[model samples]
Target: MLEMRKDLFADERDDNLNEVGKGSQRQDMPGHVTARTRFFDDHAFDGLLHLKVVRSPHAHARIRSIDIAAAARAPGVKRVLRGADVPVNKNTLLSLINFGKDDEPTLAVSKVCYKGEPVVAIIADTEAQAHAARKLVRVEYEPLKPVFDVEEALKPGAPVVNETYPGNYFEYHERFDHQKLRFGDVDAAFARADQVVEARYQMSPIEHAPTETNGTIAAPEHNDRYVVHSCAQGLFFSLGTTAKILNLESNRLHFIGGTVGGGFGGKVDSLTEPLAVLGAMLTGRPVRYVLDREEEMLTGSPRGAERIYVKDGVMRDGRIVARHIRSYFDAGAYTRLSSYAAIKCTAHIPGPYSIPNVSSDVYVAYTNRCPSTAMRGFGVTAVDFAIEVHMDRVAEAVNMDPMELRILNAYRDGDMKAHRRVAKNTALIECVQVAAEKAGWPLSDTARRQTSVASGGAGERGQIPATVIDQRGQIGRPDTRTGGPTQTLPAGTTRIALSKEPVMEGARDGRAAPTQVPRYEPAPRHEPARAQPPAYAPQPAPPAPSYQPASPPPAPPAPAPSPAHTQHGAVRFSSVFGTRRR
Candidate 1:
């Protein structure tokens, strides 16, 4: 079964035969199938009441009024719901992942924070009607000048998105010399170094092009709980989040994962599920939401953006004396997983170098772009790119072979990192040596290394191997040659850095689920006061920034006058959908 892998290793014989190591990596298991194959025959999605969300095109705005009356009158339109029709309380994706006591509303109320923020849900008997009705519903939004960049978001004068997180910095945590390892005198070592290399490398945002776009179906399941079918990476997370959003117990949610075409960390986020469930609850009927190709590309969760600056001070003998790296990740809107991403990147900033002195700092700034979360490699990839390329340049400047430089500074068995953790799989030396050998290193100086000869002798037996100038002006392989206006970028492609520090010792330790509420540490200045999740604290007062965009007063609190219309409580599946008759 798919759950067996979570338990003990039962296929040790097969793993040993395959020469693969146990733990963390073992492919042969149940519940594993190619995306194309799984649920290939399941066509139960037809005839469901489809849902459509009306989103805000502006990055930041105050909504004045949402008139869904015309949308309700549209043919095939069952219901058009604004913030008033939503659960009184707000719902957030974070609380859902953590199985928290409460959830943020699936739809925004009063103000929408970022572009593509869901504003209202339009449900109909058919998908076409829901979509058409969505276009008909009119929303009056007061546009506001947005703070798009992270640095601008951090400035004191920047427009604030949420009143809770001030200064546009969503969240912060700093570990000092006490928590971090500080070795030999870093300044003195740099001063005595023969050559020092400093370089800045930047990382751009990337997206996961999942074959299947996000979709969800919420149907009442006879009991009070709802049966939610979707292609989400974390089914438990979805279940918990949906329950919290509806203010129901965990048992009130039954989650079923369809064949996930691809998640790659994207589907881990909450996108269409909340809106679909809410729509179903509002209309007292099943609601289904499906995101098409364009919608997925334009509005799906994207990769986090990063800027990294690294400096290395090395001795004349090619000994790395010290290293320093400063990294910043654009945490769009909410902090999301960017904080954890920053830490992972920073921890690997020093890379596999066995330097005496190393110090690194990482910062995550809130931006008005898509909410950045986990990508394939997270923040580690960004820093890894910066450090490796910096090492390459340091080798060139010192007139030493790049491979030699890496091997010399690379960690050996039982070596300790700057973070005080002992390296378990210190294969840096072997990796460097193996890669150099494969690239045909240590070539004799007298050997004629030819790349390309001539077009006339291309396929002839007695043709001279093509000889061309290498990128570095050395006569070598013409295959490495480039065309006109060749410009080289600073080597900054992010690679795997230091091993990820596991969130907990082992599954048995049972401290907290990796996706559970992350223990937040306050800023250095806010020390002695641990960062607590919003679940424990009262919501902050309304935000009154210095610069106010001309906008209406925030909408009055959502109406909760109708008890039967309440989002949760006494809302059985039967109440949601009357008995279907012929």
Candidate 2:
């Protein structure tokens, strides 16, 4: 059976999308079969110049002087470009969001703070020539003590990576060292009867490690116009930032890129395309700059290093009353999105589990290693690993099953979060239940009851009892362990046990059975419907879509209410199904 159809049973009803459970054809499979795919290197043109960069060998150093004379005199070398040759030298990223500390220099002018930092560009007629000439570009440097550790860098006496930060920390207006999040009385929650569990999580900076090294080809058109071929994922962002870096109007530059080898946020950085375009303009020739494996690994932006200290005050029964998390993201040498990364880290701390009180402080610290840029999961990845490990630790402290703990604290559709927003359309409890059933974990009576109560969902299925879900909407049930509640239920009187499974079931026997919930089916239509099958399945030419005369597409859903979390860079499409185009 095809993987998609593996769940098919003897008596399963059909949905409108028959393609949902069928083997589908991959559009790109033919290209791979015929071996006719083209990458950047496949394109060739006359008067093409290969560009190589001279980079810093030291982690931290002052550029005493640079002499491009020897490289300019080298055979096959056309131009040895320095910082001064570039018309505009500045960062053009996230300015609208007002990201503080714009300190990433396009080319190192007077100082190099990280190893592999670009110092000079050597353009030549051939790749080997460019490589030979780049080695000839001599640079004098005065080595400075490198601050590689975040904790040390935050110290008063530590060597600062960039002059923008006074104490190696990214500070907002009024010199705040970190962002703060507070809800409820965290101190009082800790003071009340509870067992406090704490742990620290840390990791070093990691590189993106893409298969195809960073490469870009630039060709300048007439009248300061340019057509640039780049691997940068965000087209508008790449174009806007490149225009800013070149100090040119948006219309002057056209970015072209669709297929990428791989870019998990690492390619979001506009690193070298502007310079390549500038080089092409200066020489009036198409220019290609491709970083070899060594350069890409050394200079490419990677996810920053992070350290998180999570402290949770939980009742003996597994209810977390208070959580305090302190996180530090080390953006080595430069603040490429590290400040934003810090915010994401703090936001992800404490994870998905519900808690009464939360207080967090996330800091972005600068160090003397390669600058950390956003990679896959950038800020949230490491913190999640830390939080999960901490959750298991919390389970150990409370002597309860981790899943049981999650059941008691799972956020529900009306539960107010630590952030002011009320949770909606939440399926955390259901997801946990499904996974637990599949794994065949033992489910206690309280667990079963909680699941039943929480699943009394509102909306299309008809009103089940609004009271089934309390004002909080969490799965709270009558005491199954005791005539009342479990030991986890109360310190003085009653508190929910983290080890008990959540409340549940309109009706089910004691043994756990994982059954698929019926998918929502639209109201019956009075017209004949098209038989939709696999996209690639040869079935005597599939019929056209069956839209009835004067009928309309499904009405777009109303916009969901924004949660308490600050909307930063969220792309909300108001024209979902053309509800309102503008």
RMSD of each: 18.1, 19.6
Model 1, 337-429: lDDT tens digits are 665576567557578766766666566766667777777878878788888888889988888888777776776544545654544445566
User: In order, what lDDT does every prediction score?
Assistant: 0.58, 0.66
Candidate achieving the largest lDDT: 2
Worst 10 residues of 2 by lDDT: 466-475
lDDT of 2 by residue, 260-303 (tens): 66777778787768778888888999999888888888889888
Candidate 1, residue 122: how far the Cα is off, in Å: 1.0
Q: Report the lDDT of model 2 for residue 246.
A: 62
TM-score of model number 2: 0.74
